[model samples]
Target: MPKPEPTELSRPYWDALREGHLVFQRCSCGNAWLPARRHCPHCLKPEPRWERSSGKATLVSWVVYHTAYHPAFESRLPYNVALVQLAEGPRLLTNIVDANEALVADAPVELQIEWEGDTALARFRLAHVTV
Candidate 1:
């Protein structure tokens, strides 16, 4: 399997993830971006800077993949992958710890960092959600 690629535009986001912080690009025009970009979508200006988020969110939707499309995900089958609307104003797609179906949609969650050497990927889990 191959490693994931990070473009220059997304370096800050990936870097922040490694440090256990959920940072988003905040534009001077008052817009916040997800999946980080270099220019502000609203103003089309280089008015973006990384800002830390509160790390809180609500599960908007998710899928339980019984199959793995990549070798890296093969051992982690049946994991809950989801899109969460963070308190910071961006919707992030991440994973949740394997929990019961009852805790699927609309559950509150928080961001966590999955470290791989010098890099880390952002993952999420049920916040205060008891097993």
Candidate 2:
């Protein structure tokens, strides 16, 4: 598996995931985001505060990759890559841990951290669904 190369700015995000907490950067302008940056993208402010998530999210959209885009992912072919929006307002690309057939539009999801070597990945699973 290709591992994440955490930059100085993103180290804290990785560390928090490792410690079992999912966090996001919130600026004074009230914008929160992920894959951290030195300045807030909204107000261009420096040093936004970090806040822990409630581990709650909403499934926005997703697609199943029947073909591997990278060699390392061949074993995991036909996986669903989803766009999920956190309750606090940040959206991230992640995987949904549920049967592809069970996925539904706007389903509620909760955090599910998975480990890759020493890196903790922030994935999610369905909270409940009917369809």
Candidate 3:
């Protein structure tokens, strides 16, 4: 399915996805931003530096969806959608691989970049956990 276009506020996020990195804006004023804002909410500074994320995250919650909100998603029904807590302290909403569902709840997952057309979005997969 064709991916949707990103707005100006979300361009950096899509760009970072294409580069195979999870980049978030961090201000020297001790602020970490999410949702790709134009400036730090606390200090109100523009052009914050892009920080490379560790790609490490833990699943916070998930639901096994059986419904499709769009026709493009009908084939992907029964998939698991989840919210993950990034190691960097941001919460990311993403999809979890089905093969890893047994380990999903509270399980660690790593960020993966998938390009659909010119746009790229970040996804997640099971993180190899060692006993």
* Best-fitting candidate, scored by lDDT: 2
Report the error of model 1 at residue 11, Å: 1.5
Candidate 1 per-residue lDDT, tens place, 13-115, comes to 7777777798888888888879877688889988588899998999898888898888788887777778888887888887876474756678788887777
lDDT for model 3, on a 0 to 1 scale?
0.79
Decide which is better by lDDT, 1 or 2. 2
Candidate with best TM-score = 2
- lDDT for 52 in candidate 2 is 96
51: Cα error in model 1, Å: 0.7
lDDT of 2 by residue, 4-113 (tens): 89888888888899999899999999999986988999889999988999999999999999999899989987899999999999999999989988888899999999
Stretches off by above 4 angstroms in model 1 are 100-102, 129-131
Q: Between the candidate structures 2 and 3, which one is better when assessed by TM-score?
A: 2
Candidate number with the higher lDDT (1 or 3): 1
Provide TM-scores for the models: 0.85, 0.95, 0.83
